[model samples]
Target chain A: MSGLTLIASYPKSGNTWLRAFLASHLRDGRPIDLNADLSEVPNLTSRSLQDCHAGLEHSDLSRQEVALLRPLTSRRIAREQPGFYKTHDSNLVPPGAREPAIPPDAIDRVVCIVRDPRDVAVSAAAHFGWSLDDSVDRMADTAFCIGHSPRRLNANVEQWISSWSAHVESWLDAGGVQLLMLRYEDLLADPLESFTQLCRFLDLDDTRHAVSRSLEESRFSALAGQEARGGFRERSRTSTAPFFRAGKAGEWRTALPAVLAERVVGTHSRVMARVGYG
Target chain B: MTDGLLCGWRIRSDIALPELLDWQGDDRIPDLVVRLGEVDERLPEGREISPLLQIDGTGAGLLQVPMVGRFLVRPSGGITIAPQPEASEAEIRLFLLGSVLGMVCHQRALLPLHASSVAIDGGAVAFCGPSGMGKSTLALRFAQHGHSVVSDDICVIETCEPPRVRPCFPRLKLWRDTMEDAALSPEGLERNRRGQEKFHFRAPHAGVREPLPLRAIFLLRRAGSGEGEGIQRLAAPLDIMAALEAETFRLQVGHALGRAETLFQARALIANDVPVYRLTRRADAQPDRWLDAIAATIRG
Candidate 1:
């Protein structure tokens, strides 16, 4: 609760869902406004936050410089602006950087949400307008990163997400921070139990009614309906479907081709099985 | 050593600053002097303003960019830079004129907005925003139409009645796609940093020597799909003040120098006297669609 309490996850891995529950829970079960209220657990990598702390524009720096600079700013954010923040950064060291962007000393705790790689591929594809094959390949790519600006400035600082398997393993192996791992499928199965665990981990009000009320407020249907009415600012610019498209698990059986699903499972088999994911 | 004009100040520097205009003002002891010297890793009595910035009790500031260099800025208008052996001039000049310039403005009690402004209707129409919000890109669009660019990254405000903007050089830093969209080639232009696609495209026209009256301020933001996109004037004083505060360059340095009241008054002046607006552009839509609308809005 002192340093940065990060809700860290890979993209399309129910990161927003956890943040939404926390947002409502923090307000004592207030009905959450999807767009406006999410700032309670704001994105840690947002460009403005990085720029203000870094004292220089990330757009002007090369990738290596940004990688080096992030850890410094991370410590600043920890010391000055300590609170809940969401990120999709892998815990591994980025390319050309000595340490992870968010070093251990800068973190109070980590609530890492990981989803089944197969479902993540389907969700990521729809969210990014990538084909399922491309999504699978990108998630398997060791050098995969997000928010990198090649030809223009990106909205957020670059995050070295690496491969999904590497991403999963990195946080699992992260030291010196209290970590709580949650499976996206488990959250979907029993929202009350999963979210209660989340609240307890973060030392919030963990009573059943409070947890259930927050879970009910931030349920998948409500979030989808809200996005349908007013667009999600966090939605990818290239997103083909709605930001909350098909929150169900096991949809890869239908949406994803067999080969693509196989590729995800093959590359991420060890981490997947270790996390009790299919 | 090179002599140049930046933010209406005669600058004599050992570093080459090609973006600045050749000094035309009568030499009366250069207002700012830049030289090569040793810079310490950290200030002993200085308080940390940010990860890379520090400000001492004397209101002097130190800025160190890891691979570039360190800029030691004093209240007496002296700057000392110790560059890395491998640092390029482009990278060195970037911080010298950018972050160092903002620090100087704070030291001089001037307001520097993190904006890119161009002359519209013979006055400065400033576009303020955080990085990647298209402030420079919009200025580039205006510059392409032959509008005189007042400033690229930091817009210095002369705390006068109308809050005139001191004209910096018309060196706009643009990304590769932006230049391509504007039909300008990036082949010969120098990159903002090595291995970056962003190029420094200098406007062919010489910069206006005199400060232009501050006509309007537009805070640029990107709207997501299904969200409203247009220019809406901020009428509330708090909203305008908040927007201006958000866009103030190196605002923390100002506060650290015990200039919070001065900055607050500066923000109050903009909020009270000038018309500030929120201009929203769709993230996926054609960005140039707003050029004409912005011109019309500014003209009105």
Candidate 2:
């Protein structure tokens, strides 16, 4: 049992695919269908506030008083047993509201999947049921810089493009943690190879055959089926919403209205160029 | 390049960094590294480097904390400002810096605690809980009433021999929703650059109080319909040990038996020697009642 490995991604990034691949590998090439038994390791993100409170009461004496000063504080806890934890939030300095949710210092390794912002905007729009223009607009608000100031800094697509770069930068800066960046398109192109590399970085033996059984083209179909049946969404312990949405990369091409697509390309041209997407 | 002074405890890394990078490259190396105080324009490259909490000094310990992410020059020429990372802006960077620093330091002198600490009548009181448990809100409420806040969200717990837990650092962090709920004005809170999500409070030290003889440890929760009822005092040292460790342990500091762990265990042993109470408060009700109960316990 080592520390928890976090598969972190911006929402709608290829986090689910990575998680599925790893899960499949860990399960030894078994088809981790919708009926997979995830009772052993629960989703911290989906865990209900009520469940956490109730669960605390039944804790053994060691858990009752174990001080969690660091977000990765559960390294010891995981050393006793390794579990997979996934999160969308970035690591914080003073342990912001989200970081404290898990034991600080508990994350032994982090796998980040970065996609072109254009693709991300398109993916985000479809998931949130927003129009392409609306998604691009939202991404441009530069994280909604509507703080107390009247002058809203109009950060166009450049800011959105830099968002992922900034995120990966922070993770790398924080030493003792290994970060693996995977492009969404690259993952979509070759699921098995992508997952195998991910496993190697995570230090998990690739013998699990997670990709072999899942197949390539069927991966998306299976994921789509899972999403249709609300498999990934169901796995979420929290009642927030379904997680699996459209997993396509170039969805913005047709899905994004022509005008909005131009605005996205226009604004994030630098960023798009960086990821070789523009 | 300005002279860099080594702080209280200096850790030098063998890994050399490019002459310039955003923030300090390593938390284990030293707290602050300064090239140019306010005039420095070098920003950390790559997405991983955060703008908050840079290492600046004559060399190492002799340093300045940036004010509102800007260097504030003191009239007396002592430019030591405590820069609280904008919660909404650099949440991840700040969090990671604190986590890494807290880890490499080995919880020896600086222990990270998943609790909120506030200076109260001649001592400090810490409320420990997990996320969504309202630790920041509780601490902010007390701070508003003139109780000096030592740390919010995460408190660096420093312990001396004989086992006294002292909170180092002055700041409180709140979610956007919590700030709204607590009615705290966001005029002063800093916004993060990347995500318009969270905010950080720059706490001003107003009241003078001693490192409280660990007052009382309360594991908080939003009381439900039926749960542990009433205010019951936990008498067993073992029970106290269990509860305190769960709430206060910094696992990132590594080692199953670090000095900080030993000190914390020792403090809990003494705390178990003291009074431990469970205050079941209405989730809908204010935290005042629990505060009053803690005061009474401390007094008695």
- The numbered model that scores best in lDDT is 1
Q: Please tell me what DockQ candidate 2 reaches.
A: 0.04
Candidate 1 — which residues are off by over 4 angstroms?
B223-227, B284-299
Provide the DockQ value for model 1. Answer: 0.65
Q: Over the full model, what C-alpha lDDT does candidate 1 score relative to the true structure? A: 0.89
Task: Kindly list the per-residue Cα lDDT of model 1 for residues A13-125, writing each as its tens digit.
Answer: 99999888889999999999898899999999999899888877888777888899999999999998999999999999997888999999999999999898999999999
User: What tens-digit string does per-residue lDDT give for candidate 1 at B114-183?
Assistant: 9999998889999998787888888887887889889999999987787899998889998999899889
Model 2 residue B163 CA deviation in Å:
7.9
Chain B TM-scores across candidates: 0.97, 0.62
For each candidate in the order shown, give its overall lDDT on alpha carbons: 0.89, 0.49
Cα-based lDDT at residue A77, candidate 2: 39
* Share of native interface contacts recovered by each model: 0.80, 0.00
